[model samples]
Target chain A: MNRTTTEKVVKSLKQRHRKEKLFKAAGFASVCFGFLLVLTLISDIVIKATPAFHQHWLKLEIDYQQEWLGVDSLDYEKLESADYRKVLRRSILAMMPEVSGRQDKRSLYKLVSNNAEFTVRDALLKSPEFIGKKKNVWVMLDDDVDSYLKENTEFSQTGIRISEKQAGWIEQWYNNGLIDKQWNTEFLTSGDSREPELAGVRGALTGTMWTMLVTLILSFPLGVAAALYLEEFAPSNRFTDFIEVNINNLAAVPSIVFGLLGLAVIINLFGMPRSTPLVGGVVLTLMTLPTIIIASRASIKAVPPSIREAALGLGASKMQVAFGHVLPLAMPGIITGTIIGMAQALGETAPLLMIGMVAFIVDVPMGVTDASTVMPVQIYLWADSPERAFLAKTSAAILVLLTFLMMMNTLAATLRRKFEKRF
Target chain B: MKKLPIILSLIATSSNLMAAGRDTISVVGSSTVYPFSTVVAERFGKTTDFKTPKIESTGTGGGMKLFCAGAGIDTPDMSNASRRIKKSELEMCEKNGVKEVTEVLVGYDGIVIANSKATKQMEITRKEIFLALAKQVPATDGSEKLVDNPYKTWNEINPDLPKTKIEVLGPPPTSGTRDAFAELVLEGGCEQFAWIKAIKKQDKNKYKAICHSVREDHVYIEAGENDNLIVQKLTTNPKALGVFGFSFLDQNSDTLQGSIVDGEKPTFEGIADGSYPVSRPLYFYVKNAHVGKVPGIKEFLEEFTSEASMGEEGYLTDKGLIPLGEAKLKKIRDQVLSFTPLKL
Candidate 1:
C-alpha cells in the first residue's frame, strides 16, 4: 500500500476514537444530571419532614381544684361534663402572674394546645385521686410554639403567629428546661383535625387501605377472567380485535374522566352514597381494569404454545390445560400487574375528588361505606392549609406515602424473583 | 382469593346499612366558609354525643346542586355559601322536594389585597385599583372613551402610590373570591367615573363587561385556589401583591399585611361592621325535612348558633370569622331556632 493511503487510515482511526469518547461522556453526564435532580428532591423533602418527627411538650403544674371544675365529687357523669378548660387556663395563668390584661391572659393561654384540657381530663379520669391535688403534668405545645421552637434562631424568628411575648415565654421555658422534645406518636394514631398539631394520617391510611382492598378484590378477578378468555378462548374475529383496541385506548384515557363517570353513573344514577371508599374503589377499578387486563394478556401470551400442544397430545382437555398449566405459569406476572395497579390506585386523588372524597373527615373510617379521604387528598388539603405548621406535616406525609409505595414495589420485585421461571 | 366472597358480602352489608340512613349530619359548601364550619363541627363533636359532621368543600354552586337534589338521606343536610342563595337557586330547590330550608347567617369574611411585610403597606383606593387592573381603562384624554389599559405601574395610575410594576397574584375565575373581588372592588372603582356610572342603567351587561374583565397581560397572574402558594410567592417577590380571604392574613399576619382600601383597614371589627367594603356575609342553609330525620341536626345547630361559637368573642373569631352584632345575632338565633323557611 502507498504511504498516503496509510496516513489517511490512521487519521480516520483517531477521529473515530474521539467520537466514541465524546458519546460516552455525554451519556454519563445525562445520567448524573438525572441522579442529581432526584437526590435534591428527596433531600429537600427529608429535611423539611425532620421537624415533624418530634414535637415540644410543656410541663405544667395543674391544681385540679374541685371548685374550679364545679363538681362536688369525682363522679363519672360530673367528670365527663366538667369544665376542665377553666382549670387548665387557671394553671397556665399561674405560670405568668405578671400578665393581668385580658388580651395578655388570652395570649398566654394560647401557648398550650386547645386540646390540653382533654388531656387533663383524661389524666384525672384515669386517676381520680388527682382531682384535688397539684400534680406536674406534661401537655402538648401549640402548633405555633412547636414550629417556633424548632425553627427560631437568633438571626431569624419567622414564626408568623408567635407574638413577642409568646417568644419570650418560649425562651424562658427553654432556659428553665421545662420543654420536652419527644417522639410524636399522636401524629400516627389520631384522625384529621382543624388544628395542625392534632392532625394525623391514620384516617387517610385506613381509607387508602379500604379503597385499595376493594380495588384489588374487584379488579383482579375481573381482569384475569377477561385476559384468560381473550388470550386462550376468544377466536380472532373483528369483535375481539375491536375490544382489544378499545382496551388499549381505555388504558390511555385520563383518570379524571373516570371520576366524572363515577359521579354521573355510580352516585347520581344508581343512588350510591358519596365520599365512601366503595365509590372510590369502584371508580379506580374502572381505571386499572384496562391496565391489568393488558398486562395479564401479555404474560399469558408469553406461555409457550408447545406446552399446550404437548398437553393436548396427552389427551388433556383445553380448559384443563389453560387453567391448570397456563394460568399457574402466568400467576407471577398477573400478581405483579395487580400490585402495580394497586400502587397506582393508592396514589390517585383526582378521580376520588369527583366522588366527594375531597373532604375534611375527622373520623377514621370503619367500613367501605363510610365517608373518608385518602392519603393524596389529605396531602393536598394540608398543603393548601393556611397554618404554617401544616407545611412540615405535608412534607412528612409525602415521605410516608413514598415509603408506602416503595414497600409495595419491593413486594412486587420479591414475588417476581421468587416465583419467575426463565424458560 | 378465597376470602374475596367474604369481602364482597361485607361491602354489600355495609352499603345496606348506609341505605337504612346516615346517622351523622353531612355538610357541604364553599371553601371560603370551610375553615369556620370545620372548627364548629369539631367542637360540636368533642363536646357532644353526636358524630363529627363530615364536610365537603365542593364550592357554593356544587353544594347547592347536592343540597337541593332532594330532601332525603342520600342528599346533604346543609349547604354553606359565602353569598346569599340566588332566586334561580330557590326555584330549583322548589322544583325538587327541598321545599323548606332554614338560612342561618353564620358570620362575615373579608377579601384582602395583601403584600409581604418587607415592603411598606399600601393604601390603595378602589378607583386606583380599577385603573391599574381593568382590561379597558378610561382614556387619559378628557373624552369619555375606553382603551386597553395603558398604565404600566402603580405610580402611573396615582402619583402618591409606590413606583412598582402592577403585578398582582390572585385566584382564577372559578374561585368565589374572584367573583366577590370583581363585584366589590372592581365595580366599586368603576362607579367613580360619571359616564361609566350612567352606562350601568342603560346597559348593565356592558357595564359588567367593562368592570369585571381584568387585564390579560402578565401583570395579573392566576395562581389557582391555593392561598398558601400566593403567600409564599409574595414573600419571595416583595413588590407583588396577592388577593385572598382574610383568614390567611390572620394566620400569617407577621409576614403579610393587608392593604387599606377606602379608608378602612381589613380588620375583624371593620369587616364585622359595614366599614370594610370587600366583606361578604357567610350563610348556611339547612333542609328542614332532615332536621328530625338526622340524629343530631338540631343539637348541631344549637352548638353552631350558641354564644360560644358565633358570638363576637367566640372561638370562631380566632379563626378570622367576623361575628354579627349583638342585636342581629340574637335575631338570627331566634329565626334559626324556629326553622323559618327563607321568604325568598
Candidate 2:
C-alpha cells in the first residue's frame, strides 16, 4: 500500500509539472503575439510611407517665351492670365514631335503635372530675368509617371492613366538619365491640396502646435490647482468625495461625449468660432483635465509624510508646507503625467471633428482662432481622399504623428527615472 | 466675493463682442458639397469685403437636422446637400418656425465605379453590379425566390468577364454618394427584373430589402467616408474597385479609370447631359430669415450664382462640377438672387 501511494504521488507531481510548462508557454505566446502585432504595424506604415518621401522629376528645356506668356515685364495681372500651359505643351511636344493628333498630344502632357505651369510662373515671379530665357529645368513629374518609375506599377497595365505612347516616351526619358529622383521637401513645406502632389502637412502641423500649446497652457495650471486644493486643503466630506468620484468617472467617459459637450456648451452657448484651434483646444482641455487631475493627485499623494512634518516643525504655515515642499517633490510626476495626457490629446480625432476642426483649410494657422486641422484630422482627411498618392502621404503623416507620441512618452519616462524620489 | 462682479461683467462683455460682429456667414452640410462651397467662399472672401463663410461638413441628415432646428443669427445661414430636402425635414422646419427656405441647385456630381490604372477597365452592366453586390439576389434559374449571394468571382456572374475576384470598396450608408448610387444604379437595375418590379407593387418594404441591401461578405468592403483609402487599396490589390465622386476620378485620371456602366462611359460630357447612369444634383438651402440680418449672406449667394462661377466654362466646372443646362441654370440663379421661398 505504501509503495502504491508513493507511485501515485510521483505521477501527480509529473502531471503538475507538465501543466506548469503548458501555462508558461501560453503566456509567453500571447506576449510575443502582442510584440509581433506592433512590429507588423510599424513595418507596414514605414514601407508604404517611404515612397512618398522621394519624388520623380523630368528635366526639360522650358522656353519662357514672351509671346506665349504675353508679358515682357513683371505684370502680376497679365502673368496670371498668360497661357503658360501652352508653353508647357510646346516643350513636351518638342521632345516627341513624332506623336501627333489631339488625343496623343493630350496624353503626352500627362508626363508633367497640371500644376507644372504654375511652377514656371512662380519661377518667373521670383526672378524676372528668367522670363525671356530658355532654361533646362527639372520639373515635377505627374503622379502616374512617378508610380510607373517606382516599379510597383507598369506602363502596359490595363486602365493605365497614361497612354501607351506617353508611357513609351517616359520610359525613353528615364533610360536616358533625364528623369531624376529627388527628396520631396515640398511635402513638408506646402499646405493641403486636392492634388496629392501639392498636398503638404504644414497647415496641419501648425494647427497641432497651436492647439497643443493652448491645451497645455489651460489644462496644466487649472488641473494642478484643483489637485492641490483637493489633496491638501479641501475637507474630507461627502462633497469632496463626490467630486473625486466624478473626476475619475470623467476620465473614463468616451471622448465623443466631450465633443457633444463642446458643441453644445462652448460653440452653441458661447458662440465661439467653429473649426478653430481655440475651440479645439478648449474641447481637448476638458477631455484631458480628468487625466491631469488624477495624475496630479497620485503624484501629490506619493510625497512623503515626513517632509510635511519637517516643514511644519520648522514653523512653516500649512500652505507653505504644501506648496514649497510637497509640490516641488511631486513636480516630476506631475509633468510626466501631463506629457502623457498631451500625447493622448494629440491622437484624438472624433472630438475635434464634432466641433468643426475637420474643415479643409489650405493656409497655415496664424493664431488660435484660424480655421485649421490637427495631425490626426489631417490624416483623416487624406485617408478620405480618392487619390492613390494620398495613401502614401497618409501613411507618412501617421509616421510623423507616431514619432511625436513616442518622443513625448520617452521624455516622460526619462524624467520619472531621473527625478522620481523614493523617500 | 470681490471677483463676482468682475466675472459677471467679463461674461457680459464677451457676449457683447460676439453680438457685435455677425459679419461671417455660417454654412454647413454634406462633405460632397463642402469642397465646392469652400472654393467659392475663399474667392468671395478674397475678392469682396467679407469674412470667409464658416462651412462645416455635417453629413446630409445631420445638416438638415441643424438647419431645421430654427431660424436665428446663431443658426447656420445655409445648408449644402447632395440630396433634395426630405418631406419630413420640410415639415420639421415649418414646425420650428422656419417658414421660408430657398433651395439653390448648384450642379451635378457623377458617381463612378473606378479601379486602379493597373487593373483592366471593367465593362459592367448595372445588372451585374446589382447581382454581385446585393445581399440577396434572385435565383439565377429564373425562380422568384431570393437567396444569399453565392457569386464570388466576376467570371461566375458572366463568362465574358475576367476570372479575377469581385471585390468592391464603397462608402457606408451615411454617405450621400452611397444614397445616390443606391437610388440611381441599384434601383435602376432592380427594375429590370419584371417579377421584382411586380413585387414592388405588392410589398414596398420587401422590395426595398431585396433591392437596397448590400452583401455583408468580404467581397464588398464598407470603407467609411474616406474614398482615398479605397483608391489606395485598389492600387495595392489590383483586383478591387471603388465608388467615389467624379472629381476624384478627374484628379487622379493618371492612376485610375472609371468603369463603363450600361454601355455608357462616366465622362464629363456624359454626366453633364445625363447620359451617365449614376449622377445626382447638389444643392444648398438658405434660411430666408438670416438673409438680410447676416452681413455677407446676399453677396455670397450672388457670388455663387453668378455666371462666372456656375457657367459652362466657369471655375466650378474646372473643379469637376458638371454644369447644368443653360435653362435650368438660369432658373435656379434667378430663384436664389430673388430669395424666392421654395414651395413645399
Candidate 3:
C-alpha cells in the first residue's frame, strides 16, 4: 500500500471514531435528560404528597354526659339517634371559655372536623361505661387546621383558610402539647367525603378493581380467540386483510370514541345503569380489545411453524396443534399485552366521564352495578375541589395511582420472565 | 371457558337487579351547584338511615336532559341548574311524561373576575369590561355602528386602569359561569349604549348575539373547567385576570384577589345582599313522579332545605355557599315541603 493511501485511511478512521463518539454521547445525554425529567416529576409529587399521609389530632377532655347526648339510658336505639354534634361542640367550646361571641364561637368550633361527632358517638356506643365520665380523647382536627399546621407550624402569619384567631388557637394547642400527628387511616379506610381530610380512596380503589376484573374477563378470551382464528385458522384472503387493517385502525382510535359509543349504545340503547363499574368496564373492554388482539396475533405469529409441522407429523389435528403448541408458547406475550391494555384502561378518565363516573359519589360501591368513580377520576375531582388541603390529597392520590401502575407492570414483567421460552 | 360463562351470568344477574328498581335517589346537575348539593347529600346520608344519593356533576343542560328524559326508575330524580329551566326544556319534559316537577330554589353563586395578589385589585365597571372583552364594541367615533375591539391594553379602555395587556382567563361557553357572565355582566354593559338598547327593542336575537359573543382574539383565553389551574396561572402572570366561581377565589384568597365590579366588591355579604351584580341563583328541580318511588327523596329534600344546611350559619356557608334571604328560604322550604308543581 502507498503512504498516501495509508494516511488517507488513518485520517478517515479518526473522523469516523470522532463521529461515533459524538453519537454515543448524544444518546447518553438524551437518556440522562429523560431520567432527570422523570426524577424531578416524581420528587415533586412525593414532596407534595408526604404532608397528606399524616393528620393532626387535637386532644380534648370530653364529658360524655348522658343528658348532653339526650339519652336517658344507654339504649342502642337512643344512642344511634343521638345528637352527637352538639356534644362535640360543647366539648370544643369548653376548651376556650373566653370565646363567647357568635362568630368567635364559630371559629373555635371549627378547630375539630365536622365529622368528629361520629367518632364520639361510636366511642360512646362501644363503651357504655364511659357515660357521664370525663375522658380524654384525641379528636381529629379539621382539614384547615391540619393544612395550616403542616404549612405554617410557627403560626407567624395567617393561612389562606386559617384566620389569625384560628392560628393563635392552633399555636396554643401546639405549645401545650395538645396537638399530635398520626397516620391518616381514614384516607385508606373510609369512602369519599366533602371534607378533604376525611376523603379516602378505598371506594375508588375497589371501583377500579371491579372494573378491571370485568375488563379482564371479557377482553382476554375474546381477544385470544380472535387472534388465534386470524393467525392459525383464517385463510389469507381479502377478508382477512380487511379485518387485520381494521383491527390495527381500531387500536389507534382515540379511547373517548368508545366512551361515546358506550353512552349511545350501552346506556341509551341497552338501558344499562349509568356511572356503574359494569358500564365503565364494558366501555374500556371495547377500547382495549383491539390492542389485545393485535398484540396476541403478533405473538402467535412469532411461534415457529416447525413446531406446528412436528405436532401435525405426530398425528395431531390442526386444532390440537394450534391450541396445545402455539397457545402455550404465545401465552406469556398475550398476558403482557393484556396487562399493558389493563394499565391503559386503569388510567382512563375520559371514557368514564361520558358515562357519569366523574361524579361525587360518597358510598363505597358494593357491586359492579353500583355507581362508582375510579382512581383517576377521584384525583381529578380532588384537584378541582375548592379546599386547600385537597392539593396535597390530589398529589397523594397520584402517588398511589403511580404505585399501582408500577406494581402491575412489575407483575407483567415477572410473569413474562417466568414463562418466556427462548426456543 | 367455564369461568367466562360464570362471569357472564354474574354480570347478567347484577344488571337485572339494577334494572328492577333503584332505591336510592339519584341527583344530576350543574357543576356550579355540585359542591353545595354534595355537602347536603353527605349530611343527609350520615344523619339518616337511607342510602347516600348518587350525584353526578353533569352540566346544567346535560342534567336537564337526563332529568327530563322520562318518569321512571332509570331516570334521575332531581336536576340541579344554575339557571332557570327554559320554556323549551319544560315542554320537552311534559312531552316525555314528566308532567310535574318541583323547582327548589337553592342559594346563589357569585362569579368573580379575579387577579393575582401581586397586582392591585381591579376596580372595573360593566361597560369597561364589555369594551375590553367583547368581540365588537361600540364605535369610538360616537356613531351607532359596531367596530372590532381595538383597545389593546387596560389603560386604553380607561386611563385610570393599569397599563397592562388585557389578557383574561375564563371558562368556555359551555360553562354555567360563562353563561351567567355573558348575561349579567356583558349584557348589562352592552345595554348602556343608547343605540344597542334601542336594538334590543327591535331584534332581541341580534342584541343577544352582539352581547353574548366573547372575543376570539388571544386576549380572551378559554381556560378549561379547572379553576385551580387559572388561579395558579394568575399567580405566575401577575397582569392576567381570571373568571371563576366565588368559592375558588375564597379558597385561594392568599394568592388571588377578586375585582370590584360596578362599585361592589365580591364579598359574601355583598353578593348575598344583591349588591354584587354578577351573582346567579342555583336551583334543583325534583321529578314529582319519583317523589314516592324513591325511598329518601322527600327526606333528602327536607334535609337540604333544613336550617342547619342552608341557613346563614349553616355548614354550606363555610363551603362558600351564600344562603338565601329569610323570606326566600321560607318560600323555598314551603315549596319543597308541599311539592307544588312548577307552573312553568
lDDT score for residue A206 of model 3: 86
Which candidate achieves the best DockQ against the true structure?
A: 1
Clashing pairs in 1: none
Residue-level lDDT for B262 in candidate 1: 89
Better of 1 and 3 by lDDT: 3
Worst 10 residues of 1 chain A by lDDT: A151-160
Stretches off by above 4 angstroms in model 1 are A1-18, A154-159
Ranking according to lDDT, highest score first = 3, 1, 2
Q: Rank the candidates by TM-score, best first.
A: 3, 1, 2
Give lDDT tens digits, candidate 1, residues A1-423: 599899998979989999999999999999999999999999999999888889899999999999999999768888988999998999988877778998888788888987899889888888889888988889999998888888876413537688777787788887788999998888889889988888899999889889988898889999999999999999999999999999999999999999999999999999889999999999999999998999999899989998889888999999999998898889888888888778888889999988999999999999999999999999999998887888989998999889888988898898888778766
The per-prediction tally of clashing pairs is 0, 2, 0
Reference-based lDDT, each prediction: 0.90, 0.84, 0.91
Give model 2's docking category: acceptable
TM-score of each: 0.96, 0.79, 0.98
Count clashing residue pairs in model 1: 0
Q: Among these predicted structures, which one has the highest lDDT?
A: 3
- Best-matching candidate per TM-score: 3
Kindly indicate the candidate among 1 and 2 with the higher DockQ.
Answer: 1
Q: Per-residue lDDT for B1-344 in model 2, tens only?
A: 46646644654464456555466788888999887887688667645667767777788888898888887676778999999999899999999989999999999999999998787899999999998898999898989888899999999989988898889999999999899988888888888889998999899998888888888988888988876667667778778889989988887786789999999999999999999989999999999999778888899989998776787866687668998878888988888889999886
